[model samples]
Structure formats: C-alpha cells, structure tokens
Target: MGCCVSTSSRSTCSTRSHGGAVSPSCFEVGFCGQKRTKRTFSDHVIALQHLPSVPNRIFTNGKSRTSCIFTQQGRKGINQDAMIVWEDFMSEDVTFCGVFDGHGPHGHLVARKVRDALPLKLLSSMHSYQSRQNGSGRTCFRGNSKKSDGGDSEKDGSAEDRLNSIWKEAFMKSYKAMDKELRSHPNLDCFCSGSTAVTIVKQGSNLFMGYIGDSRAIMGSKDSNDSMVAIQLTVDLKPDLPREAERIKRCKGRVFALQDEPEVPRVWLPFDDAPGLAMARAFGDFCLKEYGVISIPEFSHRILTERDQFIVLASDGVWDVLSNEEVVEIVSSAPTRSSAAGILVDSAAREWKLKYPTSKMDDCAVVCLFLDGKMDSESDYEEQGFSSATLQSNHSGNAVESDDGQKSEPSLQRNFTVRSSEESDSYGRLPPEFEGNADTVAAEDQNWLGLEGVTRVNSLVQLPRFSEERPNP
Candidate 1:
C-alpha cells in the first residue's frame, strides 16, 4: 500500500484527483484551516495514497513504486535548507528529488532559488542533449533499457556511456547556469553566500545522482544476510579530500583547519584568511570562485535491484551527528513512510543540542525515498530485525560526539525551530575587503595560477559518444 501523510488537521479548499484518488494540495490549505499559500512546517507532508497512472502524461512519471518524505529544522536564523520533489519532473519516466543547504549571509535565498530552478534547468539540458542526438540521426532510450544494434556486452557498455555523457553535461551546465543566475540576481549578493546540492533523478530502476559540497546521498539495501546496510552513493566534496586540497593549493588557494577545529579543513583565499569555506564545490560563493572553489558537481549512477530498499539525501547537519549506519537504521525502521524524514531530522536536532550546547544547531533537511513501497511489508521487515517495537525500544539510537568533544544521547523530541542568536560562529563571513583582495590577486595570476588546469580537471572525463557522426547540413 502506498501512503501519504498530512501533518496538519486542516483541510484544503481545492484538492486534485489523480487515478480516482483525491489528493490534497497543502499550499491551498492554511494552517488550522485558514487560507494561505505560504508553506509552513505543517504542510510539509505529501503522500500519494495510490500510485498514479504510470507511463502516462501525468505527474510522478512512471514511478509507481516510489514514495518520499522530507523534513527540515532551522538554525542560526532562517531555515537554510530547501528541497523539492517533482514527481513528473521531466518525462513520464523521470522523478527528480533534491536537497540544498545554504550557508553565509544570503544563503537562504540562494538555496531557495536553486531549489526552485535547478531541476527545471537540468531537465531542459537533458532534453536539449536528446534533441541534438535526434538531429544527428541517433535515438536515445530512457531508463535502464536501450535499443541498440550491437551485442549484449556492447549494448550494456554503450547504454551506460550514453547516459553518463548526457548526465555529466547536464549537471555541469545546470550548475554553471545556476551560478550565473545567482551572480546576476539583483536582490541577492552571492560573493560570500552559497549552498550545497545533492540531487537524484530516478528513471525506472536506474538512479542518477549529482552532488556538490558536503551534502550526501546514501542508499539502504539488504545484505546477503538480510540485514540492512547503508551504502554511500556520493562523496563529501570537502577541503579535506586529498585531490580537492591539492587542486586548491595548485590554484594558489590555501587549505587549512581553524585553530579551534583542527579536524575540519576549509578552503581559504591566497591573500586573506576570511571566508573559510568548508566544501570545495558549491553553488555561488563567487568570492572563492577564483580561489579554487567551484560549482561543478560530482555525478554517479546506479541500477537498483530487489536488494535496494531506499535512498536518503541530507545536508551536513544530519551527517555531522549521525553515521550512515544509524541514519539507514532509523529510516528503514521508521513507523510510517511520511514520518521517516521527520524522525531522522528530529533525532539529529536533539543530538545537535546535546552535542554542541554552545554552538547554534545547523539547519537540517532530509529527503527519504522508499523503493517499491517495500517498507510496507511488515513480515519481511520483522524477519530482518526491523520490527516496529524494536525501533521504538531503541529510540535512544546511538551516542554522538559534539563539536566541543562532549558525547551524549538524548530523547528524540522534535524541534523544527531551534535557533539561537548567541551562537559564536555562524559560517564565518569574509569582509568585503577580503573578497576584494582575493579577486585582485586572482585576477593578476589568472593566466599562470593554473585556474584553467583546475577547471579542466574538475570537469568530468567524457565518455564515448553513441553518435559519433553528425548529419551534413
């Protein structure tokens, strides 16, 4: 059974009917029955009771076996987390889900803009690539299956190559476009503001993930022993990565950890010590663009089997306090599909308070997509040691270490607005003067500082093209 939840008791004035089932639009329903369009935390839950008509010109594409839930908690000021789930994102075979975590002064706006625009832009890029292929007298198939005139092995390799190339180009261009928009936006200043993006596009059993910055994507699958395991699908592109640090140094940028937090390495300008960005890749933060920071995303793809259960994408706030194993366990063991994201974020928020009492809790956002509605099978879940009672009993979960080195496990009380103005360090901002100096230095060394080398290296290595020849005009 597919289920969707509405967290608020209020009903909506306008409801949409899909496949004989009436679905409520949270936007039309105001909190407590009033009329408003602004989405508050109450309207956050969206559950499709039944899978809509599949392979049709309707929303949710052909993803009849998919269900998703998201939850967010604000900190430091405004909620810096923004996300979207587009059921019929592009075609009848695609579903797009993304989560963005904003940092710096204008991060909230940047995150929101990216959340609203990135998917459409990405879809457009993919469509353009396909159109170009069509013009070249080549056909491209959607999802995992493809039509080819080659042998089985050749077909498999060719299909993978085509899909990878399309996605790589799409991701690279979409990020560059998004960054360009951010820079040109009249109301927003992105010099020191930026957001991390972790996105997934599901077409049938095939999954394509594009990620930048520290946010991550994790897959929960059953092991041979029938135990749940978490598989990290995307790398955390932070300054600590050897290649990332090397690239920064090669581009004349500095990479080092703060005196207080020696374990967390950050990217800095060659001329100044301000705006210590933690992630080597991100959207906006133009202040560090010339200093080796980039918006290029890392892309990966996976074909799901029966063993795959679900995928979780979240910002660093969740990953900082929770391990991959713990996150998967909590998500797989959630009592309800809609509550999965909430429960995880709730647990993270509680951990943040207990772990870093003096520090302001970082904003937390999460997207959980259960595959094949498999979580609905109670007997199989129970046999796998994922009983509801076990989940409730182990509510305490695991103990986590705080930033200040304290360790604790607290009750999973949900708090969506856990902000404090007194928090000492809030994504330490770089003075305008520092940004000015960095820009000047980067401009002077643009030719010899290896910026072109870093850019070329950051680009994904191209895969063999399926259509090698273009039709003569």
Candidate 2:
C-alpha cells in the first residue's frame, strides 16, 4: 500500500494492491468535488491518473534505497549546485546520476535546468539510435568494419568497444542539443552564464560516464586488505590543462591567471578582460564558444567489480577542499547510509572555513550510491543513539546562517533581472581602450580576479560585441 499527494488540490489518495489483481485498489482520503464511484480493483484512482510522460522516479536532496543526495548553500549569493539520482532510468537495471555546478549571475537556474532535462535528452537519443538499429536489422552494439591489408574487413572491434562508441555518440548528441536549447531559451540569457555537468549511467555491471568542467565522479573500492580506496573517474576540465589552453588560445580566446591567483587559470575574450570562466568546456557561455569553449563532454566506461563499494559524484566545492581519499574515508565512516551525503557536505563546509577563511565558501552538492548493499547496515555509532535529524537539519537547505554571519530564514525562491541600465549602451560593448587593440590586449597577461562567488570581484562580466572582420590568431 502507498499514498499519493496532490499539491494543487491538497488531497491524498491511498492505493492498495489486491492479491492476484491486475490493477490498483484506490480509496479517496478526503471529499473531492467529483462523485465517488464504486470502488473496484481495476479502476484507476482519479488522483493517480496523470500524463504518461511524467518521470516515475526522480530523487534530489534525499535518500533512496541505494543512494543519498545532499546540497548546502555557501556564503555565495545563492546555491548554484544541483544533483539527481534516477533509478530505473531507461530500464529496470539502469540508473542515472549527475552533479551540476552553475556559475555566474544565473547559474543556479542553469544548473537546475540541466539537472532536470539532460537525462531526458540522453534517453531520447539512446532510443532513437536503438530504433534506427532495429530498422536496419543490426544490433545497436555493433559498429562498421574497417578494411584490412588483405582487402577483407571485420567488425570494428569487440562488443565493449561498440557499446562505448554508441554511448559516446549519444552523449555528444545530447550535450549538443542541450546547449542549443539553452541558447534559444527566451527567458534565459546564457551569454555570460553557464553550468558544469558530470553525469554517469549505470547499467547492470557497467558504468558510462560523461562530464564537463570541474565537477567529478569517483568510486570507492575495497582493497585486498579490506581497506576502502578512492578511484577518480573523471578528469577536471579546467582551462589550465595544456590541450584545453592550447585550443582556447588558438581560437583567439585568452587563457591566463590573475597575478594574485596564478593557480586558477581562466578563459577571457580576445580583446577584453571579462567573464573569466574557469572551465574549458561548459553548457552555455556562448560568447566563448566561438573561442574554443565547448559543451562536449569527455566520456569513459568502466565495469563494476565485486570490490566496488559505492560511487560519489560531487561539485568542485567538495573537491576544492576534500581529496578523493578524504571523501572516501568520510563516507565510509558515516554512521549510516542515509546520513552519508549530509555528513560529506557538512565536512566540506567545515573544511572551507578552515582552509580559506577570507574566501567565500562555494556551493557543495553530493550524490552517494552504494553498490554492495552491505554498507547500509546500521553502524555501532548509530546504535549509540546517533540523531539523523540533527545532521540533516544542519546540512540540508533550510534555516541557516547567511553569508553575512546572520541567522535568517532561507528564501524559497529568488528573482533576478538584468537592469535596464546594464542593457543600455554599456552592455555588450568594449571599452575605448580595448577597441582595435586586440593584439596588445591578447599579448599582456590579464589580471581578472576570482571566479563568481569566490572573491570580492564578480567574474560574471558583461558580454562584448565581436568585430566581423577581425583577423584570426
């Protein structure tokens, strides 16, 4: 038996499955406007009757039978981190998980939007590919053959190779579609704002991962000595990487770090020092797309083993301060499976204060999916009367301390708009000194400081119009 609540009408409907019955038995909990029909096992509940397109399982900031998710706002203006765990995603044996980190003025919205839509796009692409394969009378996991020296050809490679190829193509198509959608969204301005996504799909014993930006995914596996070890699963796509920097610079995008913070390199416009994006690839930030910034995700595949204990997906906030080993240790030491994500987030918050007292804490989000099932057993610490409520209250997005160190009620929703003055003559226009001096500006090291929400200066610089006749680098 289960209950469904309708938010629009503030009503509840109880459903029970009868033995050997083919349908649900529904009972209305309250008096509704419609007359109650005779109760029958075959009749569907009015409250439960809804669109077939609705997602059946979507978990955020909560715990499921095999996973836990949590996010905490930082000292920044708003939390720009989002996460999800969708079980039974494409089939009974498949699951999807992702973590997104948004940056710039409207980052929170972009992150949330991607979290809710990217999976659906990927699913659609996968189905389309399968349909085409079926129509062609070929298996989806088979690729074209390559001619050999003897003029004889064979299948491209092994089954695993073909599977990887299929998923990589799906990821690329979905990512491209997602970015295109963001660019044309009427209500969203993605010229100077964007989000990072690190997603993974688990099908049976295999894992397919795709990601952009600094957010990361890792697995915790048990060693021969029964010690838990952390294995990083994705590369952090920062602008400082050699390949990334070379591409950006070749396309006329400037890549450099401010003198004060040489460790963090950023991508800027060719002629203007603005919108210092820290990542090499991301969704949105169209102004930089022509200059080598892409939404293409790096893809990888791994087969799960008996020793694999769990997987952790987190924003850079957690990775900034917590090492992979530290994160694995923290999650392993958690009092209970349901408390793992909250505890990991809380630990990151404390680390931020200790490591960067002067800098604002970045938003943190985490998703923990346990594999072995044995980890869900109650720990001895929980037996000592551990209070799960206290842990959740402290880390969950609820009444908490604001950036100013004051107690305040958390706003359920925040509204932001680009000011009319900001959109006037000053908007998307280069300053006098920057005009026709692209060479000089590109030669000099830019001193743009800090990422959005990291330092006093805002990294979300206004866009600048590009000259059509500008020479290539």
Candidate 3:
C-alpha cells in the first residue's frame, strides 16, 4: 500500500515512497497551484537527492544570514540556474552555498544534478581523507615546505600541511565523481549540455571556495578607511583568457568570438561550431570533453575578519548587468537580510530591459551571506576618506591564517586538465603506484594537484542509458 503525506495546512497531498522515492512530478492541485513542468520537476528531484537532510533554516542565522532570488530570463522557456543555501550545511558552525548556471538543451538538468550531488560527494571525500590519515598517521602532500624567514618549520608545517593535503584531495575527487555521475545518468542527456559552479563552504571564519566556469563569488568589505569595497574571490574561467584559449587550441578545439558578441570568446569543435561553449571548464558538455573542456575546479581560501561585511554568489546574469561594486552597493543598502537577493535580481531585470531591449534577458540568481548582522546603507559605506591601510594590509598577500594561528596560502591557482584512464579513480585518487612520496613532489610542476592518477573518459558515443537510481546523485 502507498502512503500519502501532508506537506502543510493546505489541503494537498503527496505520495510517500516505501523504498524507492516517489517521482517529483506528482504535485497536489491547490497546494502547489503554480505547478512546475514535468521536466522542471524531474530536475528538482534530481537535485533534492543530494540536499542535506537538515530542516529549513533559511533566513534564520543571526550572524550569517542568507537569502536567494532566481528569476527567469524574460520569456525564456525556463530558468536554467540552480542554487543551494544551507545555513548549517554539515554541522552547526558550517554553512554551505552554491550557484550553478546551465546552458545548452539539457543544461538545467545538468545544473540540478551537480547542485544535489557535489556537496555530498565532497563530504564523503572528506571522510575518506580522515580515514586514510587515521590509518597511515602521515601527511599526503608532496613538495618542499616553503619556509618563512623567522617561522618554525616543525610547528607551522605539520598541521597545515595535513589539512591542505586533505582538502585538495577531497575537492579533486568529489568534482571527478560529480562529472562521472552526470555522464553515467541514464535519463539525463548531457552530450551538449553543461553547467558552471561556484561554491563556498564556510567553517568558523575560514572560507574554502571551489569554482568552475564563469559564475563568481565576491566579498563586500570595508577598506582601511571604512569605505566599502568589492574583492573578487574566484577567477572567471572564460574561454577568452589567454591560458584558456591556449589549452583549448592544444586539445584541438577552436576558440573564437561570434561577430555580434566579439568580447565573449567561445570554445568550439575543430570541425563544427554548433555548440560553442563560452566557458573553459565545466561539469558536462561531453561532446567537448575530448576537446579541452574539463571538470576540475580552482580552489581558494580566505580568513574573514571584522572588516569583511558580506559575501555574494551570483550567476552571470547579475554579473553581466551589474558591476561588482554595484552589487556590493545594492546588497549593503537593502532594508533587511531577507530582501537583499530579491532587490539585486529586480535591479538586474530592470537593467536588462533598458540595455538589451531586443535580446532575451539571461536568468538571474543571487545568494547573499551577511557576515556581520548589521545592514549599513550606501551612504554609510561611502563616508570615504578613511585610510584603507589595515584592510589592504590584511589581504595584500594571498596567505591567510587559520583560527589555530597556522598560516596557509588562500589561493591554489593551478591549471587542471582532463585525466587519462590510467591516472586516477572516479574520486581522483592516484593509482596505487603514485602514493607515499611527499618528499619527492616538485613545486614547479603544476600538473599533480590531486592524487597520483590521470583523468579518463568513456569512448562510447551514444545516448545515456536510463535507470531510476544509477547515478546515485
């Protein structure tokens, strides 16, 4: 017998799954009157599979308040962006947030798939790191420990090295697993579809960011003179960059800008230009996988201080119309925490109408995380003339100190390429022969960011198989 569950006070009911989960398509009439289409519901289910089981705590945290707003591109069939904002993501003190921008036919599905699964996979990798270290009692990183002139090698090197090594391994493996999961999903079609991801996991004051493609993470802070400033956190992985174009060309892919949009360089097939991808790295786009597009993410860290006010994560829609400084201004001047994202989206939508009257507006989604509970007005930020010396001094160098007083470099800016089959597992682990050589690692060689193995792709050129639960989110 099937069970019926009540979602709220309204007279609506949804079927409960006994073992297998119920399809997300079945929505009660009046309760969910504004019903989502079949495709959209499917995408939501795919995303919900990996969401943390914690109760809804949206707009609840006093110190670290969070809010989100997603608006469809004017008259576009559906919004292709997906976002996740978890206040107590893994633990009470940890908060997790992500923004995904999808493109191509099945881009929405691809974005939802990553939104639901990436975080869970990352947590599993974290567990694996702990397990490996517990069994071995040694660090996994390779390279000569770069020492500071007056710093103690013993105290500074031991703990920070172990943690950094653990995080690097976890990030690489989790991302690899996410891509593998997408490629293996039977119902979903990803041959020409892909998504860009920008995620942040904040524990205490430490911020760990994992980013791919062009969606961005930026911080709004008070400078030395107490003037609000915008600090870009992730590099925009657009095909226009020299390094990105070079890599794409090396892999036999073509990079060029369309006549109308000369500023936006895109990656295309050497022989065909049907699917010109605008980003250099992404989770799917299997058609271009062999042609230079990859799933590896750039990693960075930041130690938040009193001057840091808030952080913003948004899709290109917001970035396209609003400057980083403008976004900071809008968010800072908002009346309350719950309304900041909506205000930003509304502002962008207006700009889209005014600037590109003939073009379809891109979907806009924004996530604002307020570090300090106070919401200051624009005038308050622009009092100006205050010396930004202290704020500048704090971030002058990329190095950040953890709560425990150990200093670690916040940005790990390395180029990630597709791996070969002999390289690593789906979790990006090195094939047994490459383990246990921390002393021999060469700092100059940027290729070995994860475990010892290389990247690989399946050669079967066909539609993906369909299963109710194969990819396992």
lDDT (C-alpha, whole model) for all candidates? 0.58, 0.63, 0.56
User: Using alpha carbons, what is the TM-score of model 2?
Assistant: 0.69
- Candidate number that wins on TM-score, 1 or 2: 2
Per-model root-mean-square deviation over C-alphas: 17.4, 14.2, 18.4
Predicted candidate 3 versus true structure: per-residue lDDT over 1-473, tens digit per residue: 11111111221223221112222211111122334332221122212322233343221111123343333443344566777665544333345688888776677667767876776677666545544554676432211123334556675467445545556667788889889888988887788777889988765455678888878788888879998877767666766556677788999888886674444456877666546676789988888888888899877656566787888898877766666678888988876655577678889888766655654566676888776433333343224321234223221211122223323222111112221233222111221222443432211211111112222111111233333443232
- Model 1, span 254-367: residue lDDT tens: 888666544456777666665677678889878778878888887766767778788888877787667677788898887766467767888988876666665556667787
lDDT of 2 by residue, 98-127 (tens): 998887667777887787678767765765
- In model 2, which regions exceed 4 Å deviation? 1-56, 138-157, 373-473
Q: Rank the candidates by lDDT, best first.
A: 2, 1, 3
RMSD in Å for model 3:
18.4
Q: Candidate 3 at 308: error in angstroms?
A: 0.7
The C-alpha local distance difference test score for the whole of candidate 1 amounts to 0.58
Could you tell me the lDDT of residue 310 within candidate 1? 83
Per-candidate total of colliding backbone pairs: 3, 0, 16
TM-score for candidate 3, residues paired by index: 0.65
Q: Which model scores highest in lDDT?
A: 2
TM-score of each: 0.65, 0.69, 0.65
